[model samples]
Target: MSTPDAVPVSLAEIARIAGVGRAAVSNWRRRHDSFPIRIGGTDVSPQFSLAEVEQWLRDNGKLTDVGGREFLWPRFEALGSRDESGLAVAEAARRMRSPRTRSSHPGLSDRARDLAIEAAQLGRREGPRETFEFLLQRWLETHVRQLSTTPAQLASLMTRIALAVRLGASEGGLTVLDPACGTGHLPAAAAQEYDGEDLAVLACERDPALAALASARLGFVAEDRELRTEVATADALRADPFAGVRADIALCNPPFNERDWGYEELATDQRWAHGLPPRTEPELAWVQHLVSRLRPGGAAVVVLPPAVASRKAGRRIRGSLLRTGTLRAVVALPPGSAQPHSVSLQLWVLRAAPDNPAAASPGQDALFVDATRFARPGVREPGPDWDALGSFVLSAVETLDRPDSDPPEGTVRVPLLDLLDDEVDVTPGRYTAASAEPSGVELAASWGDLGTLLADLAGHAQHLSKLGFDAGTLQTTATVGDLVKAGALTLRAGQQPAESATPPREGAVPLLTVPDLLMDGKPSGLLCADSAHAVAQEGDVVVAGVVRAYKAWVHEGPPMALGPQLYALRVDPEKLDAHFLAGCLRAPANGRQAGTHASSSSRVDIRRLQVLRLPLDKQAAYAETFRRLRDFETLLTRTDSLGKRLVSDVSDRLAAGGLTV
Candidate 1:
């Protein structure tokens, strides 16, 4: 069936549905008198009636195979704010599922009702829960700018961790509570995981619109599987809708850095059983609130800012939490794992105080896990390595089972007393045994390995020195800009797209970034379908645009998306050798120029860097020599690292009487 006459679509959504760029949609709007006129939205991104736009596209033979859900998504968004769309959908869903119920949704438009019924029919055919999830996913993609929704993968991980904690406690028939559950992802994940089991999911969201959305999502899942779900629209901190109710498991990813989260009004609230939280530390308040909602020995897993583990302002509450045995484990996640993608975050697993407070020891050790490197590369959201993360969760469960067992690498058993020092820093990195000093046997082995590496290094150095080239006379120099003007190379910088842009799904082209160039000179950024900037070709020289330390590397991999803070230099083989250009780009003189330019703002203008002007044959000849020098330098670095380890190992072994000098 055709879209409703009343529903409108934004230009961006129209482009997406038509399998073309937004510019194409704009061109159509301006060039074709038959194109739909604007009905709503701002002048920059005006909306057009869906029926009119679809008719125009069909008339022009530009129509594509857009899905029913895809066609309705923009219309739903055009209804109003996300909350309005959510409410309309929720009412429609309720009516669709229970047609016999009294009609109270007088606000729902006739067009919205028709679209919702069509959407619900599609849902029923595709399995109601899956279809609803698809609609919700599309809605989330559009409102990503408006909502801080958790990534699906992260939500799954959080739910898995909560379940593991529940299993560790030998709990069944799970009752899960998410106090600050935005859109109810955590609770919904729990419902799915515990399918066919008697699971009760409860959640609270301060935003009424978000609460309605969450309620709709959880209600759909509950209806599909006959699970128990309850959601309320109330501030979880100031007016906890589920107060005095204790659950077996409580999961939360509360809002961070909320300076005025009703601190003055709720200062004397009883939920702060441990201690009052400072105005600056709202995460602590969330932790305590979630803890208060857990029954005795009930487990709660909370996503918190990394600073909470070490921030001095919250030190007293941290100490109280550690001393009271409420805090059980602290896990450090990789950067980009949570919102504020640049900052690495922490997950705190807490247990409610036992009924007899005296019986609960005040100094029990807590598990500290350093999974800081566990996230996979992502374009928009940090994609976690599920296998690694799952392994960590399982290992944590096993550790709880065997308290006396030695924790694995990246995991430690740190005493509460140790964490209660001056800093009261519970950062897992501080206490992890992964950084422990090597033993005598390990030291001796390192020494042995160093000797073998030294011999290999000497052989490579000898070979490099033997392939000698003549020291040429002083040559004329030209900046990269001159070479560009002479058709020797084309230099272009990568663009930095907005953070809200949708990341490419898995298996797309990988993106090369500055960090990747600096670390090992590889394309390590998340894959993206459209980079919206210059892409790196295999023969191109990718230079780090941020000149904190000048770096240049030949792009040897397949052509991929290029990220910000990088320059892609495509060389004309007939004019200049790529390797030679890379070598000159890495020269100290160019590095000095980069440093000078970067001194003001750390941004380097690569075009201004100087290079030695030489014939193609001369460039190739010098390139080979420079290549060998690079190999020599690599071996030298390895040799120096090994030598330091060897010396330290020998000294350590001698002190322990395990080896003779």
Candidate 2:
């Protein structure tokens, strides 16, 4: 095999990297003075050395041809197990990428083009392993989304796992193992966690190709210890690579909806101490395999389909485990935790033996953690928090597993009798209490005080309509300027006042500059520049507004200095509802139309806004709707927040391992 790092790139490489014709580089050098030149010259093509060219591209803020295509490099020989740079392979890849040359290879299909691109990327080394990991991660993200999960769900899962490691009951040289290791992710995570320690991980993959790839990647982390490094190509259920071995912890996310999992052969297995798992239900089989492998008093966490928690066939096995007092905790994650499919996952935490052998206080109780409530909106992952749930579960395990300790209060303890009564209903929500009321009771209590406020607003609208103003009802239509008598809406057009126009004055009121108005009619975080020309009288609609697709915020302040793009509308006494008009103009539909008409550039022009047929009444009607919508949104936000907090608090208590489920 060719030395992986000793590979060289040539003129064809330059064409591929730049995504331009070889002649384009020649034309640029011959015609432009900006091009670089090699020290030894004319005979060799004018392509700059790769490193120098890369640096120049970076300096100019230009993308190299291989910029987004970095995924093609590092895996060349390793993936294909080739020693030398296959000239035929390189030539084939080059021809496939070039449309002009592609016609000559009519035999190649669209699939062939994809393979060729992969080949090209596999042969280069633009950065370190971390960069390659990023590329690999993105690829895997796309694959998972295509298969069943979204990039967001994967990210959420990873975040939860990291959080668990950081706060959970894991201790004394942490270790991790994945029985059904796909690409050895669990082991790789373990490798990362135990970077400097002698950590052991055994991964079993049935697919030879995948096993080879995973073994190659993890060998560096595993070092030379066989126990620390095992990537055997065998079925995990039928063949336990580390047969009698155990670890500090085990983490697994097995394939779901599996049926006919070799139940006939493993019926009398020692792992099935709880009860024999039915052949029709493979989920329980995997669960049994994972639980039995745990060391005495060791903890095991596994992701399972929600059905397994209540399935009748698996009920006997699940009930046996619960009755034996080995079942520790169960947490139900929110739906959409695993993207695309939106299936909620339940995490089952089981211990091999009780922590305190002599004194068992409610050891027969299993903690039910309903963490479905604590999910934050932005976490686009498999579900709520696996890591958080794991941490809470481990914490419970620590306290409950101890030789002598009181079962902590607050954690709900469901006795085996209760579980039996419910017919082995292991769902967390089935045992935990419903969420408490929100804390903002005062805000809710004063809602009956809104009638007067509504009357006042209505009276103001009716008074405006009587003054020959069409502001109350959505009937009369008029342009903004038509209704705004020149004196009424004193249009204060913005100006770019000089920096030296005015110095900061002591106790000076802040200005309402263009930057102060956000697309959402909110003020920006920026402080406005001082200007004597800028001023805002009370009741004047300060529109530091812009007409654009992209959103921006204006600065906070009353008499703010406005940028050239700003337009301050000082409302004439009965002509328009200045607040209502500002909101209508800043509406998303209006901004989108304005953006459509603006000149094309790096940024949209926020000044070309035009309201051809809009009237004051329509603006008022819409404004009222917006106000009510905002109130509803606020209520929903509060409700969601309260629900999540309760779930988090409850999950924390249950994870201490003291409560029974």
lDDT of candidate 2? Answer: 0.52
Clashes of each: 0, 39
Each prediction's TM-score versus the true structure: 0.71, 0.55
The lDDT values for all models are 0.75, 0.52
Q: Over the stretch 12-127, how does candidate 1's per-residue lDDT look in tens digits?
A: 77887786667677888889888877887788878788777777888898865545565667667767767667766666556546655556345567766676776677655556
Tens digits of per-residue lDDT for model 2, 31-92 = 75665555332457432445555555456544544454432432232233321212223333
- The alpha-carbon RMSD values of the candidates against the true structure, listed in the order shown, are 7.2, 13.8
Highest TM-score: which candidate? 1
